[model samples]
Target: MTRVIDSAGSAYFGEAEGLLRAMRLEEALESYALAERSGHDPDACAGGRWMCHMLLGRYERAWEESDAIAARCKPDRHRFWDGKPFEGRRVIVRCLHGLGDTIQFIRYAPLVRERAKTLIVEAQPALKRLIEESRVADAVITWGEREPEWDQQIEIVELPRIFRTTLETIPAKIPYLDLPAAAPIAAYDGATDLKVGIVWASSSYNPARSIPLKQMARIFEAPGTAFFSLQAGAERSELALWRDRIVDAHTDERCVVPAAATLKKLDLIVTADTMMAHLAGAMGRPVWTLLPFHCDWRWMKRGEDSPWYPTMRLFRQPRAGDWESVVDRLQAAIEETIKGRRLVPPGDPGAQAT
Candidate 1:
């Protein structure tokens, strides 16, 4: 009898996993709920539900689900901070995700600091300089280094849940991340032409978010616009194919600070959903983000503007794997902006209608 019940529960969990992979989030959420009701790994079910709620922009519910999920998965070696008043207690916040996630969530560090006596932020080595200068925490340490001593530890992404964040209540503070003053990349030669920065690809993990270099060529069709390549990594090699059409501004020493400083110099930035989008938005720069049909939850379901970044505009694919239409809309918008019409600011009813 016990074996039969266990097998049935496993089957429900398997169905849920299949639905999630197919991007049928609503169906997947139901299947996961069914699995939980059947007593098949409550933690896994809670985690799956958390993602669904997050994607749907039901952040308050997602926060609750994530807390339950984390409680079940937390390792016994580390003490988890329960978002209590930690007066006089030391805390360590670990950046356990991508660079973009760290940049987005690090805003919460200052909130955590209000309660803790000492706060240490562990981040990727590439972001050490930027995080240190932000002063969100008392100390900064790179990942994989010796673990610093603290009374309790929390993951950076988990901070949102700890603070019980909702879409309406997201701390939409701009310019939270600061960059050191530096000369703009030489590519920005003093010109009155509309200077546009572009990032055509993202990390290889989710290729769906990326637009093929050849498909994006139409964006260069707009005359009198100087395009600068903000793309880094091996993807930068693709510039050779453009025949000097887009100037590459990325370099070995161009860390977050320099890259951000360069982004601020541009009149506009058109990028796929990547770290560049977050960096540009955080700096309060005018950034138009190109997103896949099923984009990350932060962008929400449908809209031209983002609540998190007031200066950022969103251009989403009409259908999955349809970058052509998105590019068409982007091109039209670019042409309009070059003609002296600014993008409608966030909170304007007209912008929401767009």
Candidate 2:
């Protein structure tokens, strides 16, 4: 017997993959839809559609697409927990993506614990202590370490889908991760000043999420505000040029607890879309996130306030690749806040541009 393949479906799927790789999510989603209509196996395009729905802030639809994506992409080698009612079952949650993703989704650990008798969380090594201290799981283990016995396992990102989360129903509880009792206090001489922590760059792989340090010189020059560097990694070296302009608050990069503790002391945080934004948001601190035109879906399509973090305020680029305008608006907002002006709250039309 011979098998037949849909040539048009394959072409559309290939185009969708290329568009998604180019970060053109909307176009990729259109292509994926076309691929599905042209007789492509729904399983083959489920992951692409899921990514599009997620980036488009269509959470309910994203949730619907998750099951197929999981089945097609991550076939469970062990018993998988798919939000079923299981009593006295040992479950393990695996961390499958970047550190920022682990930080963002670890809040669901406690919710997962409610359905299982024993919950073990496997995370990146850098997050082991933080996750353990959060008390979200019964046991904590880092990846690459010896595996413990568990009856079922699921990825951390899958928890939202398993729980059937919507934009309104996101677990927006703050302070999910706590600082260790022995963590050191962040030292700064800005007791009376408006201490503003800033992060200019993110991981090099996503250059669009980062702002050039030189472009932020005007922000660092703002008066009545003390700037602290919450940056880690190679980008921290840029602080040397502005040593007199910004405080070096870079602690050990291996752990985020110290940085989280440091962020608690700041009056507000101004940062790119990095782990700092997630940490500050998770801690329930006031955070102004500067986003590019094509930002992550969690920030949503058009909103200044995040459904995931109530205390967060967004500053989005007016047009694609136009960080200058965003910076201008950020500088204005900072100056207005410094002068004690009544700023428009998030979700208000006035707050969208500035």
Candidate 3:
């Protein structure tokens, strides 16, 4: 995506977005403040600064920014859920962010249910079916779908803030999301090889999150590995040349239940910072998430493993746009996995334990 945005505070805020992408958190913070002073959306700019603070591992500062933004924005502004407790209140948790966001943060549902008398989830239509299978909510509804009733509401992304989550306090439980009952994925051609699913692209809104499919040629060279295309959308067209090498596992784009079923059959999932990574991690499956240098704050400041998902491994670029080294590491890891295949068989419950 281009850095040229045409809207209030676009100049400074847009520059801040670019800065964040470049891993310049401190300068991004200054630009966010400048954007707010220049009449850009204060809440939006604060959200940027909140992410920057989180990337810097300054969780307390991030929480402080969240508090300030919560105070300035009203309930109608669609960013509620302050630090107040809601032990016995009827609550509605609305999914207002991307699918990966909902998939990642939905781990907090059981905690919410423990406190709230009842909890309703207003989720995106694409995720409603999968979310329902989780059995974490009293009820699940889609965007335009009607609901019985809700006494109070909170944006799903705000759950971490309301809970005052720090690196250590993060709910790192796995398999929080469940797969709906569906037919298993069609059989793969290389049954004897390690079955692995791969996704190389994210939404066009953030092209930086995507890796060129051509750059991933190394992983295909891993011996005893069967590659599957879990990738969706126009990006699937990129797989045309590699169709003979990688099995195309895509069915309907709108329905994700089938994909979840497919994931259950795979030994491992390798994807960018997209919903697939979150889905695989949430399902307690072994997943390796490839990230850009200017990655999202959720990945944290630095680490190979993620605190949010113990089963997940992160492969970040050494510097901005250097996917070659990332792929080299990936190829080596896949080879290592192949060598240790006998220790942890495919579909073994112990595979996810690591």
Candidate 4:
């Protein structure tokens, strides 16, 4: 989005948004306080502070705001888990956010399942097949499909808070969402050396989460690495321009399952901050996630590694709107890794990668 504030907004609030966008959490928190004092929306200011704390790895501070907001949002509620014990009660874990949100948080399903008499997940239809195949829940359902007997209900995002998640306490397990029976993409080239999958765009509503396809051109310059487009939507069409360089790996399949199948066959996945990134991480594949300077709370501002996903590495923009630098770093990292790989010289048992 634009750093320039529009004509109608309060100056303090505008500055706060700008600072937050740049990942300056300390300054953003102070600016949010100024916004609240200057008669800007108090709730909005609190929300901004809430995000800052979340990014700072201070879950307790963020939840303090959540508690206050939930109290105010009562009856017309946003918080779903009502802070009650539901041991032995049938629980319905509802996914009330984006596909990426559901995929990332669904790792907690097994924990919930262990405590409840039975757990059913109400997930988006696009993900129903994947979640079911993973066996994370006892059963998966979508909205308006069917109603099973459920005693306790909680939104999926609330699982972290319910489990009292701290940075150190995040469940860092891998292969959490597994579809063992998923067939490999029929068109895969079966490259044993190195096959790379790429997704350079995400929802248009959040352009910051997407990197322009042209920015990834340098990646194809590396020799001996096969590139494939795991990209979807309008961005997939952009692949036509680079046909000679990157393979269009997407299939006619409609749901998100194909990406999983495709990910399993690739040696590495390089994607924007999209559903594909979360999926690759959950599946225990090597993935490098390209994030904007000011990204979501889950990907805290300062790290190359994510606490939530063990196999995923993060590459954040050094500054706002600077995809060039991010791409430069990525290209260098790939070249280094390729050079780091040493051939074992057939049957030389001592040279195993381990």
Candidate 5:
């Protein structure tokens, strides 16, 4: 059975939409390419293609497509066009997503800032404060409250590859974040055993991609490992079944302070694909990330490590939503950790071994 239809451009749009809905980025890219080749308006499919590439970690391709669209877009008063005067001389990053991604990719800010008078446009108020705190950008503007009119813009997601990033290229220095001391948090001193921080789920929008809370219960089973719940919101309700054994850090903001003092104090952070993982990785903290079978391509296909963060280790599902095998592997690794074993270093063959 053919996945794409060729009838009256129905097949074309159908295939593109289906691939996009399924998050089959490469397939969607090909569909968009075919659409463009078949005399369809390239701009009509550019935005979809751009998003697909961005999701797939095809930063260079995404930027190229985004640039193509920008070149074709009539110079309007929208914020996207704000960086025109500084175009060739500097890079303008159009920010995307929550505080985590902004902080994760902010590693490239100095690089871009070095080359261009950088301006970051964020969608959240927290992001604006975080960026300013880190001093990552020359200007940290918000997409909240005010939508500044711009002459040119580029997506922040495309920065890493645009700077020609690889695994070795990640800036692994800790304390890159300059969180102020308005609210101070003491180091995790309660646990006498090896502290293990955990995050059960990411935002609900990507449920299929997040490890279920039930699956996370197994992590606490590892011997002598003190598991702390560093999650927000539903953290209390979800981990309540674990009772006193689990550390309830969510009662106060000190648990997951923006400065990351709590996460940094832990020996390891086991989390799903969320800002916590990104923050932990950026801090050069040992992080094991549980991903869905169809994970973001930045994890790459069947990889033990991530190029986006040198300290990150990937624990991808063998099958979608089937966290059994992935959780089993995590359990085994944590057991080894409890046994005084180093628990296979990231990128080691043994680490990738299922």
Candidate 6:
């Protein structure tokens, strides 16, 4: 632990990771904060710290730190623009985390690739192969025995701020994900009504970000809404209780391909603060994203409208774990959407009815 403190005492790249793994969240966040103030380019470690702050429900501070990080990186945009484009420039998208992250960041692939001939680095074997072959990247490289050298590389999460996206300019469009085709699955032969893709839980990154599986019973109370299970990882086991109401897409072998296809079939996706929410936004699908009392900054500071995906309607918890209120508000919206009263973008005077 002395070495851990020593690492934290200095502006080291892997310091936050070690501190985080040691469960010193507050200390880790503080260390990152200190590093940023001390003329350190916190880089991806800074991003991780912001994510931790959000996960721990310290949102105001998280937003403050994220804004700081964004400010720090702003100068790079100019430097990058001044340089020659892709003439030996290597813009690296570090997606070696999970499928949802890769899926979420894939929205920026086209723009990043346009700026520089790019190489995508993915950890998951499935996504690595899919991204390599698909239209998302010029080339895809998986983590291997050697770290392939590159001239200039940026994390995909940085793309939005680099593009200067605000509440008015979210690149919200669907089919952002393009996976290879495989065998077709059974159609969602539910009660041919309002199809709602339900993602109650996420991979165990932030437990606070997820709502309980049992709380989903509140959504089922919405009459005539067909729910499909989109929960991935260990959370998929929770679907057994809602077997009748759900279509089992998680068990399928062609995981990413079918999931993307299934998302195309849905009228609406109701999800938590996971990558699915981002995926739904990317696809430009009509979605209701359930948010924590203090949400991820991309959802923006206020209102249900997300710049990330204009079609996505946000339902925030009035307080932590207040899924009842969140679900109730979403239910009313779903009822309206089902009856042809769509949830239009906020600020539309006509969007509000008497």
- Per-model lDDT: 0.81, 0.81, 0.85, 0.85, 0.67, 0.64
- lDDT by residue (75-106, candidate 1, tens digit) is 63333566576678898998878889998888
Supply candidate 1's per-residue lDDT for 120: 94
Itemize residue pairs with steric clashes in candidate 6: 92-153, 174-283, 174-284
- What's the C-alpha lDDT at position 334 in model 1? 84
Q: Candidate 4, overall lDDT? A: 0.85
Off by over 4 Å in 2: 1-7, 10-30, 39-41, 70-84, 144-148, 180-186, 341-354
List, in order, the clash count of every candidate structure: 0, 0, 0, 0, 11, 3
Compare the candidates by lDDT and give the number of the best one.
3
Tens digit of per-residue lDDT, candidate 4, span 1-354 = 223332223788899998998788899898888777766766788889989998999998887887776767645354667678868989999988888999999999988988999999999888999999999888899978886999989989888878878898888788988777666565564565568999999898799999989888988989667898988887788988899989898854457787788888888999999988999999999999999987889998788999999999999998888999999999998987776665554357765331
lDDT of each residue in 152-177, candidate 2, tens digit only: 88877777877788887788898888
Q: After superposing candidate 4, which stretches have Cα over 4 Å from the reference?
A: 1-11, 37-40, 73-77, 184-189, 344-354
Off by over 4 Å in 1: 1-11, 14-24, 71-83, 144-149, 341-354
> Candidate 4 clash total?
0
What TM-score would every model get versus the actual structure? 0.87, 0.85, 0.85, 0.90, 0.74, 0.66
| TM-score winner, 1 or 5 | 1
Report the C-alpha lDDT of model 3 over 74-164, residue by residue, as the tens digit: 5555566655577888898999989989999999998999999999998888889888988999999999888767677899988987888
For candidate 1, the per-residue lDDT at 193 reads: 67
What TM value does model 5 have?
Answer: 0.74
- Name the runs in model 3 displaced over 4 angstroms: 1-19, 26-48, 73-76, 82-84, 180-182, 186-190, 342-354
Shift in Å, residue 72, candidate 4 = 2.9
Residue 328 lDDT in candidate 1: 89
Clashing pairs in 2: none
